[model samples]
Target: MVTDTAFTWSDAKRECRNMGGVLGVPSSDEENKFIGQLADGVVWIDCNDLEEEGRWKCREVNVEVAYRNWMSGEPNDVDDEDYQQCFTFMYDDSSCPESWHYWGNSCYKITETALTWSDAINECENLGGVLAAPSSDQENEFIAQLVPDDWTWIDCNDLEVEGIWKCRDDNVEVAYRNWFYGEPNNAIEEDCAALAVATWGNK
Candidate 1:
């Protein structure tokens, strides 16, 4: 019963209960493997330490998490952010490529040479990645900070269907957009989208 749509942790828990099940809290190695395989990507489980740092518990069942599978050096509270206590899982334990930045289960890197959106897509593909396609505000900010004060090409476009944008990386319809005022106007039949000064437009 994996829901592909994104939801806050609480919302997810409630949704799970509504379906007559609790949040997926693996209690054993086999359960962990099953849940990890079920969730092909980062997914919210029931594990969190919000009540007390370093004391993880499954909120739905009100039980301490006994089986742990923390990523290397993880659960260490990266950047010491107090709210970094929730847990998600995937089997991806490999490291990111050299010079590539890692965040939210993805690796990112900026290109040295400038190219048109089409060429940029090819460049990234050649390097074993897609053109950066941020799916959330935090991810957008992460990419923006990578190359501040400059426009960067993301894999967003409406070329396949005017006004219907998607991230070419996975051809998934974009659910998050940060458009500039009066932008995406498709001026002169514009199709590609880009981040301009941290705002998005198809100009």
Candidate 2:
């Protein structure tokens, strides 16, 4: 789905990702015409030539585009004006920094910056992702390796119904939980979840 908010190519991709989607990829002439009509300004579709110039592919997926509707004389490889690599539209996936470890189909950007639950989540959102969500033992183990002794903002919270935690990304109540020793007492002010420091390693 295309967003109404105007953003740079990178920002647009990130925004759609946070919403669990990729930018729309119009795969046909009819679809392209429809999108062009639906848009007010230039709406980014899923066309990009990131890997190879002039060899375009739909950003929403990795495979090469089966059809193209580029305007005539468009994509003129106008160099020197600036580096225009990724296209103005459509969804593509990701590759996190080397510092980020990949596990269970997701990249974990573990950092030491301390922030409140809300602020932490916001920071993550700005980075094109959400606070980490661990729904299984394997995923939890990955988190454990990254944060064994210190707290980190996780995706579980009782924000919807105190004492009933849920995953912020999916809005589904958690069926598995890993609370600290004598924790989650529903402290009048505590609605968020954190990984309690187990051994105090990096602080």
lDDT tens digits by residue: candidate 2, 45-140: 666676676676674445555766545566786752122322322222245566776544457787668788889888888877788766655456
Clashing pairs in 2: 23-91, 44-88, 44-89, 45-89, 45-90, 46-90, 59-91, 60-91, 149-197, 149-198
Q: Whole-model lDDT for model 2 versus the true structure?
A: 0.61
Listed in order, each prediction's TM-score against the native is 0.53, 0.47
lDDT agreement with native, every candidate: 0.72, 0.61
Global CA lDDT computed for model 1: 0.72
Candidate 2 segments exceeding 4 Å error: 1-94, 170-174, 197-203
Which residue pairs clash in candidate 1? none
- Candidate 2 C-alpha error for residue 75, in Å: 49
Model 2 TM-score (2 dp): 0.47
In TM-score terms, which candidate is top? 1
